[model samples]
Each structure stands twice: as structure tokens, then as C-alpha cells.
Target: MASAPQTQSLPLFYKELIPLSRQDHAKYKMRPPETAPFLANVHAVPVTVEEFPMVQRRMPIVFSVGDDAVPLALMGLNEGVNLFVDDEGKLTDNTVYLPAYIRRYPFLLARLQPESEELSLCFDPSVDWIGEFDDGEALFTDGEPSEFTKQIMQFNEQFEQAGQRTAQFVKDLREMDLLMDGEVSIQPEGAPQPFIYRGFQMINEDKLREMRGDQLRKIVQNGMLPLIYAHLMSLSLMRDLFGEQMRSGKMPQPDAGV
Candidate 1:
């Protein structure tokens, strides 16, 4: 595997680098009108587990991003991704599982959405475990145990399964980078584990998009988000180098083989 070169640079302005606005760019044409390849066959399903047996919850394995809001499509444990729920009903982990698809090609967590069409992204950050509540079943109501307890059990199962599901996705993600193929040597007994994804790379992509509205358009044209994450820039000079690439499709593809 080829390693990325180290860089030491100063910061630059966003406006100065990726100077091309949507009105002036052409490669910003990656999508047709209605193409949501992210949510193909997934749908929400009940997840029943002992840990959260009295909660009502569903896990979304797939996603459909549009102008209004994206929807999650969660399939069965064997069929699709899982919804990660903390023991306390709070969301501790979340992501998709791609056992086979990612083994062959690189999947960029990118700004692939087009403004002209009703677009959906491949990721979201709004769904997280919000902690647990004993929804009336733990205590009898009107001198009777709530029948809804079964539904609650189903909800908790979904969340627990989601965690198992997300764990696999993180595994698949590490497989995409160059270092993931190496031997497992870095460790210490009982020490806090290091994360597979970190900092900006682990950011809620949906939140990043929400924060960067028009700026994303230019970032797409420049194709700089992934570059920066690969440590190819200083926060200051990102847009300038990104802008140069946007003006010309001659940007070099970094050799980040898995």
C-alpha cells in the first residue's frame, strides 16, 4: 500500500481557493433529476432484544436523501445494516454495513447530490440513541401490565441489532484505507481503544452538508473534501488548491489502496 506524503502548510481562505460558485461551474453535473441509489431495497424493521424489550424503535438500514428530508430503510439483520443503540437507549454508534460491495471499489462519502434534482445522500447523522425510558410496562398501569411491552421489546432489539450492524460497517470502512491491511500490533491490555474513524472524517456528514450549503457546491466542483481528510491540505489553503482542481479535471488521484 502507498502511504500519503506528510505536509506542513499554512492556512488559506475558502473563498480565495474554491472561488468558483455554482453559477460558474460545469463539473457540478454528477446527477440526473431523481436518482437515489442509496436506498435501493432497504426498509424499516422491528428489532426485538432483551436489553430494550419494552421500547418502541425501528432501525433504518438504507437512506433516501431528498430536498425535504432523507428517510432510512432498515431491512432484516441478515439482509441489511443495523441500528446501533446504547444500553441506556442513547445512540452510541451508527453507520451502514457493506460486506461485499466495498471489497471491489472505493465508495466516497461525498457531495454527490445535485441541486437541480431531488437528491438523497448515502449518509445521515440525525439518528442516534436518545437514552432509555421505562415506557409504562415496567410499572403496571391501571392494575394491568401494558401489552405494548411486546412492542417495546421489539424496539430495543432493533437498537441492539443496529449496534452489531454498525460494527461491521466500521470494519468495512477500515478496509478502504491503506493502513487497514497491516498487522494488528498496536495495543495494551485494558487501555481505551482507538477509533477507526476520527475527527472530521467521523463528523455527521449530514450535519456537514447542512452547515456548508452553497460551499458544498464548490467543494464538489473542486473535489477537495476527501483530499483534506487525507491530510493533503492545511485548513487555510484548501479552497485555493481545491479551486485549481475544479477548474481542471487534472487533479491527481492519491494512491490510497486498501
Candidate 2:
């Protein structure tokens, strides 16, 4: 019920996050989201385990190398570059599947208190599309959440559930030592040199091949084997992405980090 401008670390596009309070924001309304300009600069986005099959079809699914080791759908090959998004924040290929993480933008669940385990639905108040308005979907009606707000709450709740499963997926991968430093290289036809990309992590196929039969059966029964194969197959698309970069003449120059 309280407004929090600086509560916790928000995702890439969020500016000011505030808990949705009917008491203080009874009249605020949300305009339909368009273009998703906030996502323009994001090169990668976290994806849930359930989304691996769909996401892997459109982009390479890699793991962020760290203790967290979250799954990320890479939208670009280099840092701060998103090949899928255009200058206006619109997707370049409409046929490409969009990640739920991006579709649930501006609205997300957050823990208001750092020490508390309970989370509350929160939104970025600074988003231009949300404000006190005479028209558009109302956030609340008669001091209670409206149907629109209820739907957003439902979506965020599902997102939270997906996050839990994603965490478990990472834990399983880590326990099996399936994650390892990854590198990819692409050579354009008739080009003198190939472009090499790094700074990410991928499944260790060698370790996967060496797993015990019981372990492999367990992973297969859990529906993780397909996800693993999807991620492995998606790596081939990295060259396709490089092709797009080449066509756009935005191939990044070789740098120390790369």
C-alpha cells in the first residue's frame, strides 16, 4: 500500500518501481503498451525453463556464467546490442517468437521488504504509458483492483512461478556440472577471417555424454533432455544472427573482451 521509488534492483528497462496501491493510485490508468521502446537496448533476456523449446527456435539459449547461472535468450552477439529490436523498439521479424519476459514488461512482482519472503505486484510508475488518465484501462475501481489489474496480477503470478522452475533448472544443471564456458565463431562466405564470440556459458556436451544411465534417464524423464537438445541445436542460429549483423554492416570490431 506504500509507494517505493527505490526498493530493489529492477530489470534493464525499469526506472522507478512502485507497489500498486489502490489507496494512493485509485485513479491511475494504464495505456496499452506499444513498440516496447524500453526493450530496444536489451541484448539478452531471462527465460523460463518452460520457454526453452520455443525460445531456442528463434535465438541461441545460453546461461549466464555465475553463481546464479540463469538462462538467457541471446538477442545479439555483442554487449548492449539487440539484433531483434529495431531503432523504434519494434521487432525486426514479426514471425520471431517473443519471450514472455519481454511481454510482461513494466509490470512485475517484487519483494517490498528486503528481509520479507512475501512478494507484491509492482509496476514502474515512470513508464510514460501509465498515469492518471481520463481514458484507457483503469487500474482500480471504487478502491479495488479492476479486471485489467487482475489480469496483470495473474500474468505476474505465472511469471513468478516460472521463475521458480527456472531456478530449479539451473540448480539441476549446476549439480551435474553440465555448464561450461562457451565460444562460437562464424565465417562469412569469401571473408578472410571469422568472427569469434565469447563471454557466455553453454551446456558441456562432453559431460552430458559421460552421464550415468540413471542420471540420463532422470533428466530425460524430467523433460529436461529436450530443453538441452534445443539449446544445443539453437547454437547453429548464431551464424544466422551473424549474417544479419553482416547485412546490416554492424559487425562489431574485435575487442579484448570478445
Alpha-carbon local distance difference test for all models: 0.26, 0.84
Question: Once model 2 is optimally superposed onto the true structure by TM-score, how far is the C-alpha of residue 180 displaced, in angstroms?
Answer: 0.3
lDDT of 2 by residue, 9-52 (tens): 66867887888898888999988876878877777888998898
lDDT: which candidate is best?
A: 2
What digit string (tens of lDDT, one per residue) describes model 1 on residues 13-70?
Answer: 0011121122232122121112222322222322212212112122212212222111
Off by over 4 Å in 2: 1-8, 255-258
Cα RMSD for candidates in order: 24.4, 1.7
After superposition, the stretches of candidate 1 with alpha carbons farther than 4 Å from their true spots are 1-138, 141-145, 178-198, 202-258
